[model samples]
Target: MTTRIDTRFAELAHKGRAALVTFLMAGDPDPATSLDIVKAMPAAGADVIELGMPFTDPMADGPAIQAAGLRALGAGMTLKKTLDLVRAFRAGDDTTPIVLMGYFNPIYVYGVDRFLVDAKAAGVDGLIVVDLPPEEDAELCLPALAAGVDFVRLATPTTDDKRLPAVLKNTAGFVYYVSITGITGTATPDFGRVAAAVARIKRHTRLPVAVGFGVRTAEHAAAVAQGADGVVVGSALIDVLKATLGADGQASAGTVPAVARLVGELAAGVRSARRAAE
Candidate 1:
């Protein structure tokens, strides 16, 4: 099945540029404002949108993303509301792929069968369940693929060649390669190593490889885009959102534009990457 994710990557390949994949927590600050940010992403040049399903214990997430989840949960966000956010976004925009990102507990509690049905109905194109490894495909990965939703897999620097095959085995949409070792938003990635890592992964799978983690600026996106099929920005965006918040930690007037402005810059970087490489 040619999902929105596959089609988007194909379109980018035709354009000869890498994709700008943006990740944001659902219901961050509040549900309504969070939806507005997501709705604004595509226009700001985001080719793929990863909407975070706020779980209490996001082991892999950095402080910024963790806090974003807490803010959403504190504001009474739930798995159902996260799905509703996707449904609402779909009402206006159908082309941009929405990938539900985060851990597995929330989905497990929500019931995988029902969540998959609702997610597809909500126009969600894919999922990035970080905790479910290839070894546990039957638990969710296989089921997600069977339901026609692209199951994007994450590969880190530690994912050796021996493990690469399993990681890419059932991976759909695109392969998200974590450029850094730690959590999101910490440390700058070594671009040379990143490029080599991307090339290494490509040797194993035909899937588009997207580099993420520590990509906070336009320059970083450009450098990574040189060898990657997509560049993902999350913590930096969350930092923008956090900086724009008012004293009460609510979305201020600058929140949306601040995030969009950075995205625009990052998009420009991504768009100009091929030229830079040449």
Candidate 2:
């Protein structure tokens, strides 16, 4: 079945531009402000939204994203509340694909069957459980696919040709190519290497490839967008939001606009990729 993610990618392809996928922690600072930030994303040029499912331990996340998760959890954010946030966002916007990104422990605790049901009903289109592997596909990936929710897989620089097929075997929506070797937002990827990596992965699967990790500025996004079908920005946005927070670590008046503005810049950068390639 064609999901919202697939439709969005197809739409962007038709428009001859890469997609700008933005990430934000659910209920960061506060649910109200978080919702407002998310609501403003699409208008700010976000093509797809990856709402973080805040967990106590986010092993794949960098310090910025880790802090964002903490703030969300400290604000009483839960898997259920995260879904509620998506549900709320869906009430107004239905076309922007919402992907719940995080570990699988919460889903295991929340009951995969029930979580899938509620997530689909909540208008969530995809998932990016960083901890889950292809060997454990039965655990969540397969079920997610059966539930019609695209389970996006990650491919790092280390994923060689022998492993690329396995990684893309059941991956849906798109393949997230981690441009760097470490955690999110820690290092900048070599633009030349990233393009080659995207090309190699495309040779393995027909699915769209989105490059993330260390993509911070519009220039960085534009560079990656030259080869990637989508440019994923997370840590930089978290850092932006964190910087805008008040002394008490609560959302300030600048938080939402700050993130929106950055997303707009990144989107413009992504839009310029094809022209730059020409």
lDDT of 2 by residue, 1-278 (tens): 99999999988887778899999999997888999999999999999999999998999888998889999889898999999999999999989999999999999999999999999999999999999989899999999999999999999999999998999999999999999999988999899999999999999998999999999999999999888899999999998999998899988889899999999999989988873321
lDDT at 236, model 2: 93
Per-residue CA lDDT of model 1 for 1-278, tens digit only, reads: 99999999888888889999999999998999999999999999999999999989999988999999999999899999999999999999988999999999989999999999999999999999889988899988999999999999999999999999999999999999999899888789999999999999999988999999999999999999989999999999999999999887899989999999999999999998873321
Q: Rate the local accuracy (lDDT) of all candidates.
A: 0.93, 0.93
Question: What is candidate 1's TM-score against the reference?
Answer: 0.98
Whole-model lDDT, candidate 1? 0.93
Which residue pairs show collisions in model 1? none
Poorest lDDT segment (10 consecutive residues) of candidate 1:
269-278
